[model samples]
Target chain A: MLANYGYSDGSGDYFITIDTQRCNACGACVMACPSQVLVTVDEDPNDPENDGPVVVAHGDRVRKLRYECDPCKSTANTTMPICVVVCKTFAISHSW
Target chain B: MSVDKQPEFWRWDETNWVNRDIEWINSEYITLGIDIGSVSSQAVIMCDGEIYAYGNMRTGSNSPNSARNALEFALEGATMKESDIHYCIGTGYGRVNVPMADRSVTEIACHARGANFIYGPSVRTVLDVGGQDIKAIRCDEKGKVTNFLMNDKCAAGTGRGMEVLSDLLSVSIGEVGDRSFDIEVEPSPVSSACVVYAKSEATALLRQGLNTNEVLAAYCLAMAQRIWSLLERVGVEPEFAITGGMAKNRGVIDRLCKKVGLEPMKTRWDTQLAGAIGAALFGYSLCRKGKSKRR
Candidate 1:
């Protein structure tokens, strides 16, 4: 299941998407996160039956991604965010 | 001092320190660390390896001015000037904007290192409740960060949240800690995690005939709970120590320690200066490395 974190604004729609099905709950994403924007939940938000808890973006950070992630987003060129790059499971993706 | 009468709930009146053990002239290297945070700023000057002078002040509107003023306050009454400092490292939110700093470091790294010095090598966990955020850090003996967690873009579990309650209750910021413990009955924690909603919750409790102290106690408990969850994410291990503005709030610290079942490591220095102290120590190492490399 895909769960999206972030909001739409005047500029455009931005999001940090987490695919729980693809995640293995390895916690690499959580450890690699510099800002602690992602955390491991006890139970999967997207799947109650899955039982395997997974990492998801912080609730407080979900709304302010555009501002909070301004530093990580490369304006000069395209580059994956640290959270996206570090996730070996390829369970995370960002839209801008 | 500004003649403003708004009750300065955000104000934390405290003095800076300068260790007398070091003589600036005799030291081969003099390095400085400036931590410019959202609510406060600090500057620490180290002569050779020991602390020489330091300043702590409320941050101003402009970060550059705040950094300069904090350093100047530390340098006050001393013969040394800014020009005499060999190197400067800036840390915290405004680290990049420090006009005088040679480089900048993250507050997380700086806090861990500072906690190491203040609380000793046993501090495996550090919970820093600064102006707008809470950080839960796990560091090794050398003060290197191994793992950490931080609250994201929220002021709910930080110094700003306490200041909001202080303003709402018409109580001085310094008085919040002592007044909270004065309440006879332990109130339930406030329901809301957001500061705005928490204010309304607090107002409702007050209208429900709770005394001001009772309401304050409730808020402190709620604040402790909010940060406690963040600490859980990092998986707390002792010896634990706390740093930043919230460390001064004994009510919260005592409750938090009780909730977590660990006694915090003690430190005589101001907890708010942890990031600056860490940055200064980093500067000391950097200067020492430079001198050794040159030789």
Candidate 2:
């Protein structure tokens, strides 16, 4: 399941897609996210049947991604988002 | 000195109605459901699984106050008092902010349950186009969500986008639907994926000698198309039902139905209260289950 979080507004689309099949509940993405946009939950809120822990975009920050992720996207030194770079499974991607 | 009241062109009606046939006082359990959505708020009061009364109103800046106002509006002219409510559940974007809610449920689950009650057991697909988001939900006969997808990030397919179009064209929100149909030829939809760009495109069309109604038709068509793509991703099923503010708009609904080749199931109750109705029903069931557990 490709869980896409965030929204498209008048400005543009800002989404964080997580491939749940590859995610192993690793907290690396959570720790790497400087804006605290990701969290590891015991259950996937979108998938009620999944009982295992998985990483998901924070609910509160989903709507405010443009602002919350501004620091990382605006910096020239960073080649990629910290969360995407740190994910060993390569299950995370962004649509900006 | 009293200032002259200004007319709010974009304002929709807010009202409450009670089922006079139900004698709520004698009911063993009375449950309340409050839905504090981004654009509107609703409160539903149920007596023994039957809808006793419901109030629909525009959401205020403060969610707690909005919930309180909606509940008070529903209780107005009724024999029941706040103390009579045995259980309370809240749903919607501001669900957690409801001061009186004993529990909170997701709007996705609440809408499925509420649609089952309002549209009947045959309903399998629910499309809720709310103020800031669009949700396409598939549910079982028992109103349990089987699968669901939600898009809250964009304003292109939402009520907020419609409101902006209405205000831009100086058309009342209620008349946008009917007036859109009045145009002789349906213009191609506005060529923008974002509401901001669409607004500018609408202004350009107006400059190019398009009438207000014609411009409205184009925008409505775009909105319908935008929503249709989302529904396609979720796979629409038979006995489809639409809830929330968009349910009341025929301009988008009619076009979308024509494109999808399926008419939406109708409901007698106000479509905006679907979330609240589901919340109240859930509360009632929880109360019953809790009672049985204690025994």
Interface RMSD of each: 13.6, 3.9
Candidate 1, residue B117: the lDDT equals: 88
- Measured against the true structure, the TM-scores of the candidates, in listed sequence, are 0.76, 0.82
Worst 10 residues of 2 chain A by lDDT: A42-51
For candidate 1, what's the RMSD?
Answer: 10.1
lDDT of each: 0.80, 0.86
lDDT of 2: 0.86
Which residue pairs show backbone clashes in model 2? Answer: A7-B153, A8-B153, A8-B154
Across A10-84, the per-residue lDDT of candidate 1 in tens digits comes to 355566777776878788878877667789987753222234678878877776777777766855664878778
Candidate 2 residue-wise lDDT, B89-169, digit = tens: 899999999998887878887898899999999998899999888888888898877656678767677898888888778
Model 2 residue B233 CA deviation in Å: 1.9
TM-score of chain A of 2: 0.96
Among the numbered candidates, top TM-score falls to: 2
Q: Summing lDDT over every window of 10 consecutive residues in candidate 1 chain A, give the lowest-scoring window.
A: A43-52
After superposing candidate 1 on the true structure, give the runs of residues whose Cα lies further than 4 Å from its correct spot: A1-96, B1-6, B291-295
